[model samples]
Target chain A: MLTEILHTLPQVLLDGLTLGAVYAIVALGYTMVYGILELINFAHGEIFMTGAFIGTAIFLTMTGLGVMSAMPALLALILVLVVTSVLTGVLGMGIERVAYRPLRKAPKLITLITAIGVSFLLQDLVRFIAELKKGNYIITGPSLFTNQVTVEASSLFSTFNNAQLKSSSIILIVTAIIMMFALDFFINRTKWGMAMRAVAQDRETAALMSVNVNKVISLTFFVGSALGGATGVLFAVQYGTIDPYIGFILGLKAFTAAVLGGIGNIRGAMFGGVLLGLLEMFAAANLSILSGGVLGGEYKDVFAFAILILVLIFKPEGIFGKAVTEKV
Target chain B: MNLLEVRNISLAFGGVKALNDVSFTIRKGEIFSLIGPNGAGKTSMLNCISGLYRPTEGSISFEGADITGMKPFKRAGLGIARAFQNIELFSHLTVLDNLMLGRHTKMKTGVLAGGFYWGRAQKEEIEHRKAVERVIDFLEIEDIRNIPVGRLAYGLKKRVEVGRALAMEPKLLLLDEPMAGMNAEEKEDMARFILDIHEEMGSTVVLIEHDMGVVMDLSDSVAVLDFGKLIGKGTPQEVQENPDVIKAYLGEEQFI
Candidate 1:
């Protein structure tokens, strides 16, 4: 059983990194909106789903137009990502303007309920558009970056097996890293970023400083949704098959990662995401063997939730969250 | 030079009058004080001027433009800066950042340039830093420039709040109790700062303060409010001599 665990570890790490990068990008969307507006942006998952379908739709069109054949897969993927992100960002802003902004003066609970309403609305809206266009809601986008490479680790160690990695996985991980660095730079070094932090600290005071609070909030949604949409394209390029429902579970898990890292901290969300992905993959690979066949790989979600509950009980501020301190 | 003209500003909240037909004019380059009992609509009048609260009736003209319906940020852009009675500094921000943010209206880097740190963003930041460093020098907060505002002592925090407003380079400065809850030393330091701000910076100041000594000493003009109505408007000595002002405020031994 130990050798079995050792043999599968390389492949698990490969898979875990790919999954973690996705969760990290998506968790960024949750954390950014939550940081500025104190809104959870419950429709974020649906926006992710919408981005996936839109990306697939764009790819299907590109393939039909023969653009995919003429251009490199990487270039086509980039094109799809840009277009899909812009569209979803606009959609996010529209949702904020029409659905959220009107209720700005309303109670907090009422605004949250409207967010749920927006989530359901986006899900159904995407559902019918997808079904009408494809005659089926489920889609498998045209393949790209299909090259697979194998690492020869068994030559050095007897217990370790060779790991297989897809070219798309490399692209996904690199893109995620580049995007994270760019966002970090944008937040820490820019005037807009300083204004964002100030607004998050105090909206009324921020306005007194001449920071346009509404414009900042709108731009935040645009950027957050844009990142979510871009990640959807990456997700589609890697996994190849998607549906309207993929966002619900994935978004919940990403939210878990956000909570695990401290919801409002950007770097914390990234760390939380990668950690959760590695832990979940580890459990998937080892749970059945360790449990003596009583528990299977399907209980991996249970294991993830167990981590969340434990964190809630023991370290509710999360790994990176600051504990509330009342001065003595 | 009348810098701010408040014409019959009345504000009511669901059948409760917070300010009623209160009107006053602030001249350029002088310290003006608003003295009132508790719940006497002093802060409410400032709110109306600063665009935080819209008066139910009347208009406010600043720098000769009617700013009665202007948004708060737009008001800030028109050279009106205010410090809060309660500290409103960004606690998570360092003292330098808190001051830099005060100059936000003057910094014009677009989001794309800001994100890319491309041409003009770097130059803009450097220029703004130079401008902000002047504020730090003027306020003498150079030592605490890198420390977060939340960790500062309360007196220092109040000073930084005024520093933030001064960073705006406002033609009119609205100070809501810059000396409240301070020791004699802190209050004297703040009064000296206010004097320097008026004498050197040459900005009009509108002050709301509870300490009669500070109000009497610092004010070129004093407006007395009671039950949301302005009862007297004159120099501090004249306001002290007015029968209505004496009967309403000074007669109370606790107030004096």
Candidate 2:
């Protein structure tokens, strides 16, 4: 029994890492936009979906037009990434401008409801548009990067096969790492980043410092949306298929990751995503023991949510979150 | 010539006049005080000047430029900074981080340069860090520099809030009830800080304060407000002797 558990350990670890990376990417969109605007961009999940659809559409179109060769595929993938990122980024900004900007000084509950409304609106719009052109429930696209380069398992771990690690997962993880580092640098080093942090800390004070609060808020929405777009594309590539409803569960999980990491803390989101992913994998692997049932295949989500609840109950600020205090 | 000029400013909230045709001017390097009883429109006037609230009538000009309809941030870009009556420090951030946020407007590196951490961005960040550090040291908050502002004491938090506004290096600084709710010792410390900020920095100050003694001691010019109207404006002694100023406080005492 121990050997069986040991044999599956590495695979669980791999699964966790992949899941965590995806959650981390999507959680960044939630955390960052939340940090700046102090409002949850409810439509962020839909934006992720939009990105997947855009990327899938672009890749399939390129393939149909005879641009499926390696070099051309790489170029087309880059084009798709850029276009999809811009489209989703703009969509994010539009949501902010139309749904959130005017309600800047409104009550928090009003804005929250508006955000929910926008989320449903985007979901319906995407569903309607997708229904018009699709016969298949899942849209399949050509792989943009699928060359498998396996790392051989050492003699000590002879039973394990490195071939199980997909090139797409590796690429996604690397991209996520690069994006996270880039985001950290942007937040810490750039002028606009400073403005964003300032606005987040105190909007009135930020304005008093001559930082254009509106422009900073808009830029925040754009960057957050762009990150969501990247995550969507990555998800599509990893799974080899894009479905309109892909964002629903992913969004909830990512949001859970954000809360786990500490909503307003960027570094927290990254760590939380990776940690949540690992936990989900471990639960999936040991479901029989955890659930005490013969069929434990579908308990991954239950386990993930269980972790979320436990964290909230014990460490509400999340693992890395700083406690907030008010001065009288 | 005055650096900040207010002309016939009036504001109303649902038929209640917060300010009625109020006018004032502040020159560079001057310590000006706006003193009034509670609900006498001191905060409303400051809000109007800071662009947080629009005046129902009249105009505001800074450095020979009309800023009546400009956004609060735009007004800030023209060298305006203010501290809130209720401390609004970013609770989760360190004192140094709060100060660094104050330097946001002065930073020059764009997102592209920031993303890569290239030459210009690095230089800019280092320079701003140095400036923020200076403010921290000046405020004598060096020990708590890395500690989150939320955990600081009320006095220290107020100091940090002042430090944040100072980091802006504004041409004009507005303090809303700087010593409100403070004990005598805290009030003295805050007063000294305010004086140092004015004398050493040579930035113009427009403060709204309720403490009569502190207001009289700190202000070079004093404006008195009684129910949204300018009852008196002159030296501290002049306002003290004004019968209308006495009546405003007298009426409040009787009602209470």
Candidate 3:
């Protein structure tokens, strides 16, 4: 067991990174919305699920039209990504306008309850759509690419001489990194991004500075949901199947990642996500050796939450979150 | 022509009349100060001009355009900038970012260009940075430019608030108690900055102040409000010597 653990460490790290990338992307939706409006946006997980469905629908349509067969694989994937992200972005905006906007000034409890209701509504809506299309509840996404594209890790990294890195994992990590940097630049450097931050800090001040508060909030939902949609498409591509219920646990975990990283901090979300992912992967992979064969891989899901509880019990502000001093 | 004209503006929250039939004109290139005792409707009048509060009745015009119905952001776009009495700086943001936010109306980059942060966005950001740097330099806050405003002292935060308003390059600058909570030295520095903003920057000014010494020394014209009514309006000497103004401040009237 010890020998097997030593041999599989590199693969576990790669798998952790791949999974971490998706969680980080999804976590952004929660963190961004929370930053601006102080709302949890519980339906955000549903937004992620919807993105996968939308991407699947687009892929299926393209295949039916014979475009997928004729087109280059990269271009087709890009097209799917763009379409799914845009559609999801719009859907996210709609959700904000319909469900969250009216409750902007309402009590926190009212907004929270609305968020949960919206989440359930989206899940049931997706399930109903799938029921109509397939005469059943579970909807499996089309296979857009090979499940595993193997690349000998020794050719790229001298340390992983015996490991074969999956191309999908590479794509996921690269894409997630690019998007994260893009988000960072947007929030820190851009005029709109500055407005978003200002609005997050103080809505009245942002308005005084000529920022349209409503517009900024709507754009936030759009951008955050877009990232979630992109992640959904990536998740479907990697897993090769999805359903209406997929976002339930994934979204909860992503929300946990947000809280673990410090809910309102962008960098915290990414850090928390990758950390959570790595911890989960390591715990799942090394359980037999670490726990003397008593604990099995079946308890893998428990590890993420257990670590979260332990870390949060000590550092409630989260690993990346600064301790906020409440002003009188 | 007047840079800002307030005609018969009144604001009431239920039965509480904050400003009643208040009328004033801020001429171009003049330092106009609004001074009054506490709950004297000074901030309420400022709120009306900045479009934070809709006047219960009356009209406000800037540069011959009616802005009574315009939104706060629209008022900002029309080149009206304000620094709040309570220091409403974005506390989490650095001084540079806070001032850059003031230049929001001046920036033309949209979401796509801003997200890319290349070409037009990069060029636009550099231009805005130069503008904000000028404000930081003028306020002498260059040392704290990169620090978050939350960690700053009271005087520095006030300076950053004014710096942010200055970054807008407003034609009409409304400052609400810009030197409210500062020490003597800080008050002097703020007075100098306000004078420089009026004289050197050529921006029209409307200020709300409680410091009698500062108000007398700095204002070209002063308007005094008492219990939501304009009780005095004149040059510093004239207002200081006005019977109603003296009565409102030192009178036996109950504090509302």
The models' CA-based lDDT, in order, is 0.90, 0.84, 0.88
Clashing pairs in 2: none
In the range B1-256, model 2's lDDT, one tens digit per residue, is 6999999999999999999999988887899999889999999999998999999899999998999999998887777888989987877678988888778778877766776778988888899999998898888899999998879898889899889989989889999988878889999989998999998888899999988888899998999898899999998999889888988876635444
Q: List the residue pairs that clash in candidate 3.
A: none
TM-score of each: 0.96, 0.88, 0.94
Q: What DockQ, between 0 and 1, does each candidate earn?
A: 0.79, 0.57, 0.86
Better candidate by DockQ, 1 or 3: 3
DockQ winner: 3
Candidate ordering by TM-score (highest first): 1, 3, 2
Residue A93 lDDT (model 2): 91
* Fnat of candidate 1: 0.78
Could you arrange the candidates by DockQ from highest to lowest?
3, 1, 2
Distance (Å) between predicted and true CA of B227, model 2? 2.2
For candidate 1, what is the DockQ-based docking class? medium
User: For model 1, which pairs clash?
Assistant: none
Error of 3 at A69 (Å): 2.0
Which candidate number would show the highest lDDT if scored against the true structure?
1
Identify the candidate with maximal TM-score: 1
